[model samples]
Target: MKTAIVILNWNGQKLLEQFLPSVVNFSQNEADVYVADNASTDSSITYIKEHFPTVKIVENTINGGYAKGYNDALQSIEADIYCLLNSDVEVTKNWLQPVLYVFKNDKKTAIIQPKLLDFKDKTKFEYAGAAGGFVDLYGYPYCRGRVFNNLEIDNNQFNDISEIFWASGACLFIRSKVYHQLGGFDEDYFAHQEEIDLCWRTQNIGYKVKYIGTSTVYHVGGATLQETNPHKTYLNFRNSLLNVVKNVPTRWFLFVVFSRLILDGIAGIKFLFELRPIHTWAIIKAHFSFYKNFFKFLGKRRKLHKKQNYNLHTSIVWQYFALGRNRFEELR
Candidate 1:
């Protein structure tokens, strides 16, 4: 199968400097590389042309955000499998081989994520997506190796290959057909949680999403946007709520929403008491805005369900909420 590797760049020249050579040297067989730049002001374009002439580079007129940037580039390419990789990741040798193995072995698998380690400190997992990802009952997404702002250490202890709720787009390998059918990443997501939305649709189509621990890549956690990155928080919070409305069944949606409301209220009160009123207020406004757009969100949710495989009362919803609260789940 033909594979096209896609990377979206936005003022990431330095990261490209460290990551490009590894990508050029390692992925040499049936795969092709494409870099879509989101109107980077930096020397990212000049650097790519000068150093990696063979790699395809698509330039955007303005910053269209991650999902739109990828959608633009993907429209022109045709491949059996599409690998969405982050610019800040350095892939290990033979990484694609194992991923290809999984894809070829399981015809039912739609997406696969590589085991990601921290680039600065290889001993730990990356913050964005360490292993595979899952969304809790409250629509919070957390990975096995990382939680909100908390990344776990790598003890080489995890070795199981199983199904996951979402595959990290940090370095995802997907079947091109499946990707096009699911309509790529939702542009409304803008940036964060877009992959989760895509994976939900994929699973709904009766396909399995797997996290293969054999293939590995090193990622610089939050390289493009650090912890205090307001863009990250805004998109994460907004898009996660959007996911619940789009994918969760009606009955389960109410349960998830009520549970989240209680947890968020307690947390907000604590923050307000501690003089951290800004954050507390931000949380309140975010949720309020989400509800304010309820009907519009519900319209989209109904649209998504027209093609859904299972309804709100299925095992999928049960498993997602059965676990304790995570990034997508709020634990009391």
Candidate 2:
């Protein structure tokens, strides 16, 4: 099948230097490469044209966020497979082959993600998505080799294909039909947690989201948005809760929300005790704002609940905080 690989860039000239070479080397004969530049103020577009002239470039008139940038770039493209890769990743030679193989062989698979290692320190796995993604009961996403800010080095530890709650947006490979059917990434999401919402819908439709261990890449985590960026934190917090509100069963959703609130409260207290009042205040503000949008979020919850067929008792997210690693046994 023919493939079109799309990369979204936002003032990331330096990243394109490392990423473009790897991408060109890896996907040269197999996939058509396209760069969706978000009107970067830097010389990113000029560099792409000079160095990679054969590569397709779609420069946006405005700096639309990640979702919109990709959506706009992909609107008219026709290909059997569409791979959304981030600008900050360095791919291996065989990275796209395994994902392509899975899509070609597995009729039940709708979305697939590659094994992601950290770029700064190649031995360690990336935090965003190491080798597939899972969520605990409270909607917190963790992967086989990473949790939150904690990343485990690649030790040939994960060597199996597995089902995941979501594919990381950093390097998501999906069938074109499935992607178009789900309306691509939700443009409303702008950036964070959108892929998780997409995968939830894919699973709802009886499709599997697979993590192909053979496909590997190195991701420079937080290249687009720093971990401490208030906006990033806000979107992550709001959209994560939004995903649960719009997907999980009513009782489970309520429990998860309350559980999340308590967790946030504890985090805030910990920050204050450590004399990081700024972080403490931000957490406090996020909680209050999230509640203020409760009714609107609940309305979405009601609508999504009507469409859900599966029931969640204890989400894979909460499993992370459980007493033993055995809690993760069923997940693997």
The digit string of per-residue lDDT tens for model 2 on 1-332 reads 99999899888889888789889888888999989888899999999999999789888877779788887888877898888999999999888878888888999998999899999999988878887887766777667787656577787777678887788999998888888887777775688888988888788777889998888898898988888776676777777777767777655766877888888777678778988777777776766666777787677555542434333325443444463332233443
Using alpha carbons, what is the TM-score of model 1? 0.88
lDDT of 1 by residue, 1-332 (tens): 88998889999999899898998889987589989899999999899999999899888777878788888888888899999999999998988988888888899998999898899999888777788887666677777777665566777655557777888879988898988887888887778888988998888878889988888899886876776554555566667777877887666778866766776677568668988776676677767767887788788777663433333222222343465333322332
RMSD in order of candidates: 4.1, 2.8
Worst 10 residues of 1 by lDDT: 309-318
lDDT of 2: 0.79
TM-score each candidate: 0.88, 0.90
lDDT of 1: 0.78
User: Ten-residue segment with the worst summed lDDT in candidate 2?
Assistant: 323-332
Clashing pairs in 2: 135-316, 135-317, 136-316, 136-317, 136-318, 137-317, 137-318
Q: Flag regions of model 1 displaced more than 4 Å.
A: 270-276, 306-332
Clash totals for all models, in order?
3, 7
